[model samples]
Target: MFIQSFLLLLAISFLSAGRVPRPEERIIGGQNIEIEQAPWQVSLQVNGEHICGGSIYSNDIIITAAHCLYEKERRLEAKDFLIRVGSSLWNSKGTLVKVAAIRSHENYNSTNFTKDIAVMRLSEPLNFTDKVKNIPLAERNPAPGTVAMVSGWGATSIYPKHSYPVHLQGVDVPILTVDQFSISAGSNGQTACYRDSGGPLVVAQQLVGVVSSGYKYCDGPTQFISVSDERSWLLNAIASIKL
Candidate 1:
């Protein structure tokens, strides 16, 4: 059971992109890029409060971190969550989709930070707009050193008293080899920070990964979940839920 759970968590981690270390150089020039143009971008809310980030892969489905829904003593239900698509700021009025079902990877072990992926089904289909559209999934394998982008509403600087950014933040990062990331991230460090999970990692207009986990310091280049690595699993999961 332990092994199964670990593997499940690893799968989720792969789906969610947890545990990225901050890069030494900060990206400051592209702050004006509009997030509204990214159709998959989503803001995750719990009990009517925006707490995290996610992305829409389909008209009725959104993906996010398993840890986002898991409390220390209890697991969250679909009824308690909502997804807002096409919103740049959390306070913006947008289409609110209530979660109808939640499917967390079976092997998920929240404590281990592996297999941290979960999919939430919306109660209704979302209307597609320039601000909201589906991001194409990557069918080919991604190589190390691939250039990609990560966006979120996470803090911009690491200070005990620093204020978290209210607008979405984005950074361009290179995909490091898995072995390299594993060593740098430490054995137990395998998850992205607040408001980053389930965000899209786009490369050449293809959705290559999902923003999962990263260092909280915001000091190094961020890590991401490799979506290309688990295309089959994601497709199967999506099919299962759609049917």
Candidate 2:
């Protein structure tokens, strides 16, 4: 039964890949920014390739979406990944560090996309600088109208004409609810694509959301995992590691 379920889920994932992009892929109608402005932003890489975005939580901790820990249907280990921080460009111009451990939320549900949070522990502590800083987590949900910002190196558009930018891009968006944000308006008909998942959504200098997944197209608002909603698990995830 477990084997059958796993196969079914894998089939669904392959079928949905082209249509349904997983949790916040791209940043449309965004402007380029220096890494110092959003010092917490970090890149998750495998073999020098930027796979996803993450944020600096502390000297040795990175926070990202739980799903980002997987590549396609295969689950990845901590040693399989490297983290790049303090860079405007995803591929270059940063400090790439080794990951010692990773812990995903125990209740993470890939089917319905719930509790999509994870943390990575670095092998060595990051040397915090003006260009490398940690952002605090949110204690409560933002009001519906609160404007937040997102930054990443994900593809700028979902169409064939679009290409992923080397520099980090950012855009401002309004909150829709506890787990939703509006890209339907000023995004200029732009939607997320690949490589942008697991990025931070900041409001008032605090991380309120983690880009989790998105639609087949820009048919509606994008869904991000609520940090406050999973604060209990997150706090435990962060506190459990002695390093």
Using TM-score, give the best candidate's number.
Answer: 2
- lDDT measured at residue 136 in model 1 versus the true structure, 0 to 100: 73
Give lDDT per model, in order: 0.59, 0.73
Candidate 2, residue 167: lDDT = 92
Compared with the true structure, what per-residue lDDT tens digits does model 1 show for residues 1-243? 011222344444343355443332232212424666565778787766666677778889887666667644467788888787777776576677788888877765565455656778889998888888877777764576666666666544323432345566665666665531121111122223355656667777777766555434334334445565666667788788877
Summarize candidate 2's per-residue lDDT along 156-206 as a digit string, tens digits.
765544467889988787776553321222232343335667888888899
lDDT of 2 at 124: 93
TM-scores for candidates 1 onward, in order: 0.77, 0.84
Model 2 clash tally?
6
RMSD of each: 6.8, 5.6
